[model samples]
Target chain A: MRWLNTRTITPLLFMAPVLVFAIVFFFLPVGFSLYISFHKWDSLSPPEFYGFTNYVYLLSKDPQFYRTLVNTFVFAGGTIAIGIPLALVVAYSFSQSRFQTVWRSIYWLPMITNIVAVAFIWKFVLNDAYGMLNRGLALVGLPGPGWLTNPSLSMFSVIMVFVWMQLGHNMLLVSAGLQSIDDTYYEAARIDGAHSGNIFWDITLPLLKPTILFLLITNFITGISYFALMMVLTEGGPAGSTNVTSLYMYNMAFSDLRLGRASAAAYILFALIFIVTLIQLRLFRRGGVEAHN
Target chain B: MADAGGIVRSRTLGSRALTVLKYTLLTIGAIVMVAPFLDMFFGALRTVPERLARPPVYFPQTPQWDNFAQVFREMPMLQWGINSLITTLSVTVLQVTSSAMAGYALAKFEFFGRMTAFRFVLGAQMFPFFLFIIPMFFILRYFPLVGGNDIFGKGGMGLLNSYLAIILPFAVSWHGVFLMRQFMMAVPSELLDAARMDGAGEFRIFFTIVLPLVTPGLATLAIFVFVYQWNEVIWTMTVTRTAPNLQTVPVGIYLLRGAYVEEAKMSVQQAAIFLSILPVMIAFLFLQRFYVRGLTAGGVKG
Candidate 1:
């Protein structure tokens, strides 16, 4: 009974599991990875300290690394540039429509489904010879290009599928943001003879800036780290056009057995993402988006 | 009176037109979103001849219900399903329990390093999982005394080729702890204080009073983890690449794509995909509100 105070001991006891996990899974792995990045090791042999060579090779010597970096940026930038606006439009429509729940559930179907399933479904739909998209194109007298097989179009195919999968979730976020706006804003705008388009642009977009920024930052982070879809859909194939950095790192570590180089690649990507995130935060603060939200 | 009525009528007409346009666009978008799934189901039922035809058949002349059964016969569908359930369920339960305990501590208890612990959780979430996969894989592989390894962790695939490999790294989620902490902060301190005054133990207070109150948060986090882990491919595929016995459904399907190269086998692959997606779809259908709440609360990283 004396040990029951709501102070140091009780909280420490409760936090023990998480503390252990943080040390073991979080801290240990991160530290070990950083150490590995500095040394050369294959699983069979002891690690040899190699000093910045791994980073040097990846940054300057490796052509594939540069290609993957470009591909990763393309995927992330394309998804944000296209997906966020598309999602906002759909969400704006959804927020204004009837049977919102039903529409939301339908759109969310792809989001809940696994990446493998989405990739495979798209695989079937984008089949060069007899797929649904091609069939539809044929029906309308339009030629269907190779979606996943052509090097030129493979990255586009992945981006389109990625956007489609992410649309519902982003739409939900935007819809939530849309719902939070005060009805008085719309009413006042209408009273001033503002058209719906003017009201949306002037009132909704300004008020929704926080949500949009949140979506942009998070989606950019996710898109950069994402590789499962590329792994399954293209396996970074079609002349390696679809290869992103994460997937490239995975192959380097596993397939190429260059554990040291893979860790370095991962850290470089992490640094890039971290810096971008900081920049986004600074921009948001400067723009006063946080103040409004 | 006539002019005022005419203005009102015109305004109503404009609004009605907008509504019609909105519904039409949304309906088309919904169709695009769902039609691929319909195509998958139809593709799974198409006969070999129909599939091989020049333009390809959009609909099956006769629905091949047998493809679903053939999936089991041709592949280890049952094993993959069981593995997915075991790993997903284990990760979910462990994550929820760990997060709740840690969250409760951070929310209610006054302790040293409390701010640091919370900050660690926040910073850790920003560390994308790609950073951990390389070292974590070796850590599991070289773990001493678990899988016939020596005292020095030298041999025998330490924890690889087992459910533990998949479940261990995910046992505690930083986001889950953060989310739980946020939820638990709202729980009144007075209730726990009253329970303590009535001679209840800390564990008892948590289980009986605190836990029940945060069940919504628990459920939200549980479903979120469950769906994510169930669909997790990269980590599972990496460790279980050679261990087919432990491959989950998504990993199994992707790895076994070579088996479905023939047109006849394509239907089987599509059927397998359908089956793999079924469980999460059913769960989402039932518990969508909680999922939405979870997504909005976290606001990122699904």
Candidate 2:
């Protein structure tokens, strides 16, 4: 039998586990989530078919939902704007510096650590009264604001911590990008007596555009979906100032038993991410950036 | 004449100044990156009296190293560590084997539905984990014929409190498959054909020949999966909220926050957090090259 032949059967055999997992764990949950989003489910009773009410409630009535949406955007935007540039600069230095491996290993520690550990470490470091951060600020003759206690500063604190956690990761990507640029470009520029700043702005920046674009898109996507740090650190506290959409959704499903509503929230966030990614792809295409390396 | 060191090595006064400035900034950045870990290490050593002091001592006088031991004494840390190891190891092994097998198939085989299957793997990676949290929870909770549940999946909690719930969802990583496929595509087809001509069965050739060829790729993916599954909190915490016996290190420490109310207890919490991260930290330090490769692969592609 052709199906029983080694070539055909072997491939099928190899693919069996992944295929089964994709169906049961990946595809089924996605479809099930969509299905559940239309109903009111509390796990204690049979789900009631509520049609679009869950979506409607979130869109038209939920102020917390709106706040979370805004908070998520802010967190994502702030991290991309601040974190990417910081990573690029650090990576630029990293690519140029000696003792590269040591610096990289040190910086990479937080990236590999657990999110809970990272949150707690920073939570202690940013303590209002006795935090090392405040103690150091006092040393420098500067006042230390409550990093996690102040509503306005809580989201920013979480964002900074998130950025710190991600710095090494993005820096490495940027460093790779920087290293991949041909030395010939720099050689030619230097022969013409181009200033270091001119070379950086004119040649280095242009050559690194693809890598930067990649970082921007990926980091933004991660930032938008990220809530673990906030969950462990602030627990979306200080009057929900740090409550991003994912944290809000987590509470909704687990704490409030609003499965349908939470699913609706997740789908809405997914849609936003989907649309943004598409727009990013379109922009990249227009900018002549090839993503498939 | 300028050497081939490029413009970065220009020996101008400005470049020298820039070099000095770069080192200064990077040194500060590295300090920022590592200081908190040092703080954690030191914080874990503070005595209860020191912790309860009005100003809150930053460093320990005697360095209560026993607090790390106390973490095990007071809490079910050994259980948590064992659970973490079991779930993480299971997920890592399953993901690596499944991804390697599937990756080899897609890279080498020309099956009827290969393209479709490959496309599904690519598309699957884009779906965020949060999207599946709700439905997957129910799916595990109502999984039939397991965890005392009947065929209709209604009699009991199903796999909700079991290790299966933690391990099963992560069995097959889409990114791992994609990465392995990328690695496998570089392997020459002639090698496999020669093995076949040598009277080798496909499974034998695969296990002995193809798997060895992709060891580096497998290492990269293994470290990647190990770190991720070890640090995974959300899904595990959700399923194990009522089943503390199954909770991993991070989840156990987080869920046990109520036990750590006092400042002295906070030191224990910090120690626990430190210990929770130590294994992965040690692993990453030793295998950082593989870790970096895996991370950059995901970062650039994702």
Candidate 3:
């Protein structure tokens, strides 16, 4: 009877792959990474138990560590400062516009394209000499600043390209939120003699608060952790002006083979991200019902 | 907000100007979105002299369409393409199969530990790719009895430098499973019960009935996985470092960046980039509907 039932066995059989994958890939590797963080490991030799040294050095002793963290925040902050509002406006525009399929196709080109190709395109576009941007600037008799070469502007260039690349995806998210607001609400607002500007401010903007806040947290997290663009675009160049924590950790682990220190850095970044998510969640939970009012 | 939800409006003068302004902004935004790509396309067609000229060429004087052909001769484009195809296809098929199977199990079956498995999936998504990069490399390197490793997973390369390393970590997509579960939940239970009563095996019922019903979800998940895996750089680059033979197109282009970074080779580089983007672009052109659905659905979810 038990064999004929096939109740438990069939489900277990079907679920085997994902369960195994989760254990092996997700849980096991994370545990191993934590264990490796406490011990100095180069993979070429037996790991030496280093205890708190790796964590301490990253937290206190490393200047590049602190600098990279700041650069990361600047990159993340810059992205939200520039990207979120731009995406919101563009998305709002997209909702009002016709020929949506055509518009969406054009906008989402970068979203579908690889990061390598994106970096290469922008590298050509932003070149100081003989580049499209500088050449355009030259025709108008305006000064063309070094977008990538200048240490101060390197992070800016990185941020702009990221924003440019991500605009379509973020727009897709915001547009989803915009479309969620019912037509009756707009009709009701219009019937109350609300002008377009005031209706936008009072009704639409308020409804979009949750979506915008969600975007802010997600985009910030993405900006902080993402360094692939920097790797292919600038390689954290011009005196490490654009260096970020994950990129630094990447090189430390793979390039320099300082696996232990890198693991400690990864843990730190993870904790910081965790803390950020918690703070945002707590703040948003308090302000959750305020959007309705 | 006046335009919210397709409201009817009288043609007031201020609203007319507003419409014009909105159109202008939309046109400008469209141009901005498309210009970089057009620039790249034109860049790919330029002659060597045009590229090197002072102030450089905005448009190609003579479109060297063969520059696309030149991409293959310049690098292992064919090899990279094949590698890319192999890895991406494997990951896609594996992820879809695994996710669908697991999703069906969790959604349809009343197993004892179903909630626990479901919770594990929900929680596992929080683990970002960065946290796994280093440890995963080591894990694959030390995987017991793989790629000539000992039982203790020592004294050999394990799964490193092979397609397995590139494919195994991504064999199960948590989000895919979650999405598939959501789709599977929509199927009525009575139909499944009827099938069971009719002496149909569970496997047969799942394959014949459930899968056909969830084609839209499968299509959504497939396109997402394919494009993502096709363009995946970081993990692929990390594992395929010593094994350049296994490098995908993006990784191949990236690692050998020096060869194509110069102004003279810029056309070929741009051509190669365009070629790399073309396959997925065309596929997306046809399947944009599913992608839009997935994007909107994913956005609505946490």
Best by lDDT: 1
TM of chain B, each: 0.96, 0.94, 0.94
Model 1 TM-score (B-chain only): 0.96
The sequence of per-residue lDDT tens digits that candidate 2 reaches over residues A9-97 is 88999999998998889878999999999999998999899999999999999999999999999999999999999998999999999
Better of 1 and 3 by TM-score: 1
- Candidate 1: which stretches are off by over 4 Å? A1-6, A289-293, B1-7, B300-302
Off by over 4 Å in 2: A1-4, B1-11, B298-302
Residue-wise lDDT of candidate 2 within B180-294, one digit each (tens)?
Answer: 9988998899998999899999899989999999999999999999999999998899999999899999999989988887787888888999999999988888888998788
**DockQ of each model against the real complex?**
0.60, 0.68, 0.54
Best by DockQ: 2
Candidate 3 versus the native: TM-score?
A: 0.95
Interface RMSD, every prediction, one decimal place? 3.2, 2.1, 3.7
lDDT score at residue B183, model 1, on the 0-100 scale: 91
Evaluation by lDDT, superior candidate among 2 and 3:
2
Per-residue lDDT tens digits for candidate 1, residues B1-302, read 56968867887888788888888889998998999999999988988888888667778999999989999999999999999999999999999999999999988987778988888888788899999999999889888898989988886889998899999999999999999998999899999999999999999999999999999999999999999999999999999999999999999999999888888679999999999999999998899999999988855221
